[model samples]
Target: MNIVCIAWGSLLWKPGPLKLASGWHPGGPLLPLEFARDSDDSAELALVLCPGVPLVPTYWAYVDAPDLDTARAMLAAREKITPGHPESIGSIPAIDGAPVQQEIAAWLRGRRIDAAIWTALPPKFAGVGGRMPSAEEAVGLLSRLSGETRAAAEFYLRRTPPHIDTRYRRLVEARLGWRPLREAAVTCPA
Candidate 1:
């Protein structure tokens, strides 16, 4: 069984807890690859974060492909759209092929799952540390999600902005309690 992890937002730059927890390395030189868009849209260049000498980390972007040829094709025709800069586009792999939900389910067994669900709140809702779900919250939410929803949510969280940073530490502290907030990496003043 194979599980695919798709990255979208900040995860594209700095992979969060999920990547770290999954034992995937973060930060490295990126390689340019071409990705095909829907239909006849022009191909875009994407920068894929390559780990050590070989072996790409599954946490970076996982997509189920029926075979190696399909995987190579998907990887070949991909593009990455950078945040705050639409013009700064590149190519990256896009997973599309046979249904691998069962494989994902089997693989998830006995494994720790860390996911971040993305939602669009008003600008005022944006705070520091971004909007990471608490450990309990993440577990609860993922427990009730369908495979596709889970996949989409993972992608969204990876691309979400750091709305929970220092600016609104006070509000978050008051809301979620100081201890958990601190432990969650969203520190606030005492």
Candidate 2:
């Protein structure tokens, strides 16, 4: 059976126990992603766009396991990848129109049991929650913080609600005077 595992948060940049057990390296030339945090209250997450599925607001980390046991084992291994703290694993039941969830369900329909599981650190312990700052605020923060921190903040900001355009316009106008919005030629690496 085909299983697709999805994970957000710290696991995106850092290699959890699962990735390590699978003989995969978390940071290297291939993965250009980086994360940084200030205290335990806020953090920034970013990744270089890779081939295959685009890692959007919700990125799906796909893995095909033979059975639920194997999937659980992988998750367990992933939990131990780190030295001190361990990541959490859970099944992502059907909810919302999440493409990753739907894809896993579709795989299960044909196969006997296309079981899948996800792994990540707890929100509180991971310090993942932060209000979506205005574009101006984000820019200011980015300038002050390191590149890794800025990238993480931008990644979260992009996924945030209330619309990027609206927030950016409001903040830009308020901070840098009123000006018409124009599409600039900016090269963003995935």
Candidate 3:
């Protein structure tokens, strides 16, 4: 199966166990995103899909899996998400025409891929009933983080793909000064 994996944040820099058949390609589908999820694993306000927000370009790479189910399982394992929580993993098969998948389905048209998957974790501020935090609230959470927790948070924000300039990212840059990191320049030996 020609399956692809989509990402916009940490996965771009630290893929951990995700098996990719190709390097990331720019110009993936545009999706609404924000740094709204307070990740338990990293204690960072991680970026997640946010429906009502501005759209940003995501990155895509071919997944090194034989089929969609295995692809999904592989991604779940890489993301550390336990079984039965399929909501955290979004999978769109070319044969399935669910209306909710129209945007991605359209993107799939004329492509060689047979399916695609992405992390679909929801917005979950710590004290806000799993709601997406406002820009101020997100920055406040980042500001309160100290020591290594703070460093991890900043690293996450800075390492996000440069094309993903979300509203919350702008706010974080303005308030916390955690701007995105650019690729380091390479030097030749003298």
Off by over 4 Å in 3: 94-100, 127-129, 184-190
Ranking by lDDT: 3, 2, 1
Q: Give the per-residue lDDT digits (tens) of candidate 2, residues 130-187.
A: 2333344444644565566655555453432211223343453465343332331121
Against the true structure, candidate 1 reaches a TM-score of 0.20
lDDT of 1 by residue, 28-56 (tens): 12211111011112111111221121222
Question: For model 3, how does the per-residue alpha-carbon lDDT over 53-147 read when each residue is reduced to its tens digit?
Answer: 88888888888998988888888888899986766778886323322445566788899888999888889987554598878888898999999
Q: Pairing residues by index, what is the TM-score of model 2?
A: 0.35
Scored by Cα lDDT, where does model 2 land? 0.39
The CA lDDT of each predicted structure is 0.28, 0.39, 0.80
Candidate 2: 10-residue stretch with minimal lDDT: 25-34
Q: What is the lDDT of residue 159 in candidate 2?
A: 39
Model 2 deviation from the true structure expressed as Cα RMSD, one decimal place = 11.1
